[model samples]
Target: MKIGDPLNRSTDHGPQNHKAHLDKLLEFCQMGIKEGATLVYGGKQVQRPGFFFEPTVFTDVQDHMYIAKEESFGPIMIVSKFKTGEVDDVLRRANATEYGLASGVFTRDISKALYVSERLNAGTVFINTYNKTDVATPFGGFKQSGFGKDLGQEALNEYLKTKAVTIEY
Candidate 1:
């Protein structure tokens, strides 16, 4: 993606939220290389004035790799191949994580997508899409990603303090 001016109306993407995040993205890119993942595309900074990192894609990523198991919050996509009918194994590997903020499943079969998304530990699951959310839908992570939400009714509940009460005769 193009790291252009954020204020520009036509800008597709912008710089990272922070320099530390950009540094971590660069570090993860290098870590992927050190861990034997093939750098398919874009692993360097944009060489611009801002903290902009290139969208990186790595192939041959293993489940045991640091980049695979760690919680990376940048534009990095790791590819691990599995057989067509091995959805169970894929789910196991996908759920084998301490942080579960979000996960994605791109499949033509609606039933399979529903089945897989339900089993994923992530709070947000995208079927045939990514990073797409609505204000009406609850958004939050299940594990170490976070405990609260930022949008919808779930976010409103964060401010609530309620307890159960009962009276019997």
Candidate 2:
């Protein structure tokens, strides 16, 4: 697979949603570099007609870096390393963000997976996978990410109001 025109259908990659999103993605990539994070992969914008950014990856990301603390909402991944014994601190750093939308945990140990998932503040936590959403499950965010659900019975409940009536017989 190669990066080429998405319209070809065979191409493995596509452009960003728009120019603004592409620019934002580029900015975050630059910020990652400026903040001393190592750029492990692509970090350039393609010269094609539509807005496109190279899929990027950053290593040695710090908790305080803008690229680490904020969501890029683009095809960028930041890898932050933590000590094995610092699970508590890592959870705190992960939950410190204003957005509590979704999170993922990839681990072979079920106990560790459950432990972290239980502590993460995000509304959706995926174990051993990522971004697994279904119509059968309620979907929403906590904190500034947003409120209320959009699917499942929980979403249906939003428009319905329960009423009670009492009659003396």
Candidate 3:
């Protein structure tokens, strides 16, 4: 796909923030290929003047694969599959990763979504969406992703002070 411009109203995607990040994303895409993941789509830089990369997709990925485990911080989709009746097993595998910055879940079933989202070990869990966050909600990671929040009420609590007084009953 073409690199989208943020200023343009019709643009849906944009280039990577910098050259180094783009390079790193390419490396991870390549690593996924070498590690036996199937490159289903767009694993190369677009023929343009900016730090643009094709939104890459890797299928046939195992839960243990590095691409599935690490964050690319770029436009990359790593797909892994689980049996239909084994969602708990899938959640277990998803939470096995040490990093818990963000995670995405895509499903039509809201009940199933709530069920899976509750068990995910991430700071922010998105349903049928990614990279979209609300400023009024707590945002941070649970494990090695981070220690503190950057937005929402939890961040405000850091700057607030509350004291309780005991009353005779």
User: Against the true structure, whose TM-score is highest?
Assistant: 1
lDDT of each: 0.85, 0.83, 0.85
Residue-level lDDT for 88 in candidate 2: 97
Pairs in clash, predicted candidate 1: none
**Per-residue lDDT of candidate 2, residues 1-169 (tens digit):** 2567778856767888888988888888889899899999988898777887787779899998998788887667677766669889999989889888777787788898899999999888888876566788998888887888889988998899899999999
What stretches of model 1 exceed 4 Å from their correct place? Answer: 5-12, 163-169
Rank list by lDDT: 1, 3, 2
Q: Tens digits of per-residue lDDT for model 3 on 43-123?
A: 898888898889888889998788988888778877776665989999988898888888788888888888988999988
Alpha-carbon lDDT of model 3: 0.85
Candidate 3 — which residues are off by over 4 angstroms? 5-12, 157-169
Candidate 2 clashing pairs, residues 3+ apart or interchain: none
Q: Please give each candidate's TM-score.
A: 0.84, 0.75, 0.76
**Candidate 1 local lDDT, 39-158, one digit each (tens):** 999888899798888877899998899988987777787777766699899889889889898877877889988988999999999888776778888898888889999899889988
Model 3: weakest 10-residue lDDT segment is: 1-10
